[model samples]
Target: MRTHFIAIGGAAMHNLALALHEKGYNVTGSDDAIFEPSKSRLQAKGLLPAEMGWFPEKITKDIDAIILGMHAKADNPELLKAQELGLTIYSYPEFLYEQSKNKTRVVIGGSHGKTTITSMILHVMHYHNVEVDYMVGAQLEGFDTMVRLTEDADFIVLEGDEYLSSPTDRRPKFHLYQPNIALISGIAWDHINVFPTYENYVEQFEIFISKITNGGILVYNENDPEVKRIAETAANPIRKIPYHTPEYSVENGTTLLETPEGPMPIEVFGAHNLNNLAGAKWICQNMGIDEADFYEAIATFKGASKRLEKIAESSKNVAYKDFAHSPSKVAATTKAVKEQYPDRTLIACLELHTYSSLNAEFLRQYEGALDNADVAVVFYSPDAVKIKQLEEVTYEQIAKAFNREDLIIYTNPVEFKDYLFNLKPDSNGMALLLMSSGNYGGLNFDEVKKLV
Candidate 1:
C-alpha cells in the first residue's frame, strides 16, 4: 500500500506513519512544521518530509490513500491536491476503522480515563500473550508505537477519542470505530470550540453509543450520572455492563485491591484509577480473560503517560504531572492525591490551557475542583488565549469561577515557577500535582524535579 499523509508531524499522525512504514508500505508525508520527538522519530523511520511545507507533487494518482491529521485545515495544499486528483482521503480514525473492520473492535471512550482503560486492556492482553492490533493515545512501556496493525490479529483495541476526526471530518473520532465492545468512562462537557453547548457536547457520546455494532457490549461507569442516563436511553442491541470503583484500601500511601486471588497491591492509586480498573476488568472478561488473570496482570500496570504519572519522588516529597485540563478530571485527580496521602500537604496546580478550560462560561464548572488541595494554584497564559483566539480571562475571573477566594492565579510562567520553587517541602509528606494538557508555558519537568 502506498499512503501519503497531510500534516504528518502530529503525535498520532507521525506514529501512524511510522507504523505503516514498519509494515513495509510506501509511506510519505508533509507538514509545515515538525517539532521534537515527532520530528526525530519520523526522520529515524525515513517518514519525515525532506522539506517543511506541503507540495502538490507529493499527492499523486498512485497513492492508495491520504491519511489526514487534525492539524491540517480543509484548504491544506496536499489535501486540495488529493481532492483534485480524486484520491481516497481518510481521516486518521476513518482509516483506522477501514483497516480493523473485520476484527473485533474494542473502543474505550470518555472524557477521562480513556487512556488508562485502554492501557489496562492492552497490559492484560500482553500479559496473557494475546496477539492483537491496537491504537492507544499514550506511549506504553513495551509498545514501540502508540498504533499497531497486523493482518493476523483478530482483535483491535482503540482509545476512542471524542474529538473531531479531522478539520474536514466533523464527526467525532470515536463514532467511526463501530465497536463490537465499547466503554464510556464518563461524560463531561468539553471541546467548547466545536460543540458550544453542554447538551451538544453530550449528544456526541449518545451518537457513539448508538453506533455500537449489533449485539456488541457496552461497559460504562455507572457512577457518572450523565453516563448512566445515556446508557439507559441507548437503543442499541449491545449488552449494557455498568461498573464502579472496586473494593480497595490505601495504607501508608500504598493502594491494594481485594481481588479473588487475594489482596493485590498496585503501583497506581486514586479512586478514579480504581474505577478505571473496574471498567477495564469487565472489558477483559468479555475478551475471555478471567478475574484471576486480570488481577495478576493489572498488579504491574503502572499508568499511562501523563495521567497522574510520577515524575520525581523522594522520602520528603513526591511530584506528579497529568494531562488533566477538564473540571471533572481536575477534581478527581486532586481528590485522589489527597486520599492516597492523607497526611501529606497536597499542592495542586492546574493550567487552564484547553479551549473548554479557558472559556469563561465553561470555567464556572470548575467550582471547588481544587478544594482538596492544601494550596491551589491556577495558571494561564495570555498569549495562549491570543493563539487560540479566545477571550482574555483575568486571574480574578478564574479565582471567582473556581469559587476559591484564596486561590493563587498566575498569568506568567516564570512567576508560577518561582511560586512552586518557594513551596517548602513538608517533612511528614508532601505531594505536588501539576495538571495540564499543554506544558505550562515551557515549565521543564527536569527543572521542576530538582526544585521539588
Candidate 2:
C-alpha cells in the first residue's frame, strides 16, 4: 500500500510514518517545520520531505491513502489538494483503527497517567516474551518507536488521547479506537481550547465509553468520584472493573509496592503512579499475564520520560522535571515529591505554557495545587500568551488564583533563571521540582543540573 502524510512532523504522526515505512509500505510525507528527534528519526528512515513546505503536486491520484495529522489545518495545501482529488483521507486514529481492526485493541485513556499505564503494560509484556503491537505517547527505554503495527500480533495496546483527531475531524481520537478493552484512569478537564466548557469536555469520555466493542471490558479508577460515577452509569454491556492505588510505602526515597508474594521494589514513586500500576496490572491480566509475572516485570520499570524524571541528584539536594501543565497533575506531583523526602524543603516551580494554563478563567482550577511545597513559584512568559492569542494574565491574577499570599511569580525568564541559580540550601535539604510542558523560556537544563 502507498500512504502519504499531510503534516507528518508531529510526535505521533512521525512515528506512524516510520512504522509504515518499516512495514514495507511506500511512505511519503510533507511538513511545514520539523523539530528534533522527529526530524532526525525521519531523516534516518529516508521519510523526511525534500523541502520544508507542502507541495500540492505530491498529492497524486496514485496514492492509496492520505493520513492527516492534527498539526495540519483544514485549509492546508496538501489536505486541500487531497480533498480536491477526492482521495480517501483518514485521521491518524482512524487509520490506526483500520490497521488494527482485526486485533483485540486495549486502549488506556484519561486526562493523565495514560502514558505511564500503557508503558507499564508494554514493559510487562516485553519482559514475559509476549509479542504484541502497541502505541504509546512517550518514549520508553526499550521501545525503538512510539508506534508499532504487525499482522501476527493478536492484540494492540494503544494510549488513547481525548484530543481532537484532526482539524477536519471534530471527534476525539479515542472515539475512533472502538477498543475491545478500555481503561479510564481519571477525568480532569483539559484542552480548554477545544471543548470550551467542563461539561462539554466530559461528554467526550462518555462517547468514548459508548464506542467500546460489544461485551468488552472497562477498567477504571475507583478512587476518583467522577470516574466512578461515569463507569457505574455507563449503559454499555461491557464488564466494569474498578482499581485503586495498591498498598505501597516510600522508604528513604525508594517506593516498595506491596504484592501477594512480598514487597516489590520499584523505581517509580507517587500515588498517581501507584494507581497507574494497579490499572496496568488489570489490563495485563486480561491480556494473559498473571499477577506474579506482572509484579516481576513491573519491578524493573523506571517510568515514562518526563514524568517525574530525576534530572540531577546529590546528597543534600535533588531536582526532578515533569511534563505536568494541567492542574491535577501539578497537585499530585507536588504532593508526591514532598511526601517522598519529608526531611527536605520542597521548592515547587511551574510554568504556565499551555493554552489552558494561560487562560484567566482556567487559572482558578489550580487553587492550592502547589500548597504541598515549602516554597511555591510560578513562571509564565507574556510573549507566550500573545503567541497563543490568549488574554494577558497578570501577576496578581496568578497569585490570587493560586490563593497563596506567599506565591513567587515571574513573568521574565531572566529573573526566574537567576532565582534558580542563586537558590541556596539551608540546614534542611531542598528538593526542586520543575513542572511544565514547555521549557522555562529557553532555560538550559544543563545549567539546572549544575545547580543541583
The worst-scoring run of ten residues by lDDT in candidate 2 lies at 443-452
TM-score of each: 0.98, 0.99
Which digits, one per residue and each the tens of the lDDT, describe model 2 over residues 122-175? 999999999999999999998899999988999999999999899999899999
Q: Flag clash pairs in model 2.
A: none
Report the number of the highest-lDDT candidate.
2
Q: lDDT of each structure?
A: 0.92, 0.94
Candidate 2 residue 383 C-alpha distance from true site, Å: 0.8
Give the local distance difference test score of model 2. Answer: 0.94
lDDT of 1 at 386: 89
Record all residue pairs in model 1 with backbone atoms less than 3 Å apart, i.e. clashing. none
RMSD of 2: 0.9
What is the Å distance of residue 439 in model 2 from its true position?
Answer: 0.1
